[model samples]
Target: MRVRRAAKGVGDFVVESIGEAVAEVVLGVLACALLAGLALIAYLSWSFSPLLTVAGTGLLSLFLAHGAWGTFRDPVEGRRRRGWTAVAAVCFTLVAATAAFLLLYASDCGCL
Candidate 1:
């Protein structure tokens, strides 16, 4: 009876805990993407027109917030792979670099 009880407990833990952790990771990655977008907007505004800078920043922020909420609505479970995380990081870095470049280059051109 004790062995059966332990097995049941382990099963429940696996089903419940694993799901929550996966959701957390997914949301976390989404957050990183949004942050990268914001940084990109900042760089744009600093380098170019105020209108575009504000619009870009606002759009990215809204999209990220929405994505975050949507992601949490569903539980994602499957093969735990490192590829998604790597992809997220790469994307964020690209956004940041692009923003920085635009801002710096535009400033030199006297656009902003």
Candidate 2:
């Protein structure tokens, strides 16, 4: 009985450890895809008119925000991976906000 109990405990620990690693991997992949998507959207929209550029980025921001919420809602169990995804979210927001601001400013100037 003692041997069996010890083995069971070890097994549970291993399974739980794997769960955290899986969470980390899943969130990491999501973070990579998100960054790539944002990059693609920016590149594709670069040549569009100022209004359209802002619109494209605005849509991207919505999706990114939703993803971030999801990340926070069910966060990864690993510290390192969670930190990375958080960094990715921050980077996306900063770049998107800057682009949106610049696009709006340019459009306003163009109107004048």
Candidate 3:
């Protein structure tokens, strides 16, 4: 049996879905840019040190996380917060993972 809602428009549902998708795409792009900027900055310094890079990237990641949290709580898109939430989670994970890998690599090889 198929039941139709009495007052829902299919167009509205489609638009809302599209908006969610767009939000996710935007968040992903922003995250990538932030990560790439961090890496590029680290590479260009030529300090021959990972510590500086790690610290800089960590700071940038923290800033992004704060922005993400603000967006997540905004009233404009309460239902679509999931998209930005995923972005924030991924960004945090990537930053942590990169830091852990660098630390492990440095400790194992005595880079300091």
Q: Give TM per candidate.
A: 0.41, 0.46, 0.38
Tens digit of lDDT per residue, candidate 3, span 5-34? 523566679889999999866655555555
Q: Name the Cα RMSD for model 1.
A: 17.0
Query: Candidate 2, after superposition: displacement of residue 17 in Å?
Result: 0.4
Off by over 4 Å in 1: 50-112
Cand. 1 TM to true fold: 0.41
Ranking by TM-score: 2, 1, 3
Ranking by lDDT: 2, 3, 1
User: lDDT of candidate 1 vs native?
Assistant: 0.61
Candidate 2 — which residues are off by over 4 angstroms? 55-112
Q: List the residue pairs that clash in candidate 3.
A: none
For lDDT, candidate 2 versus 3, the one ahead is 2
Query: Which one is best on TM-score?
Result: 2
For each candidate, what is the lDDT? 0.61, 0.65, 0.62
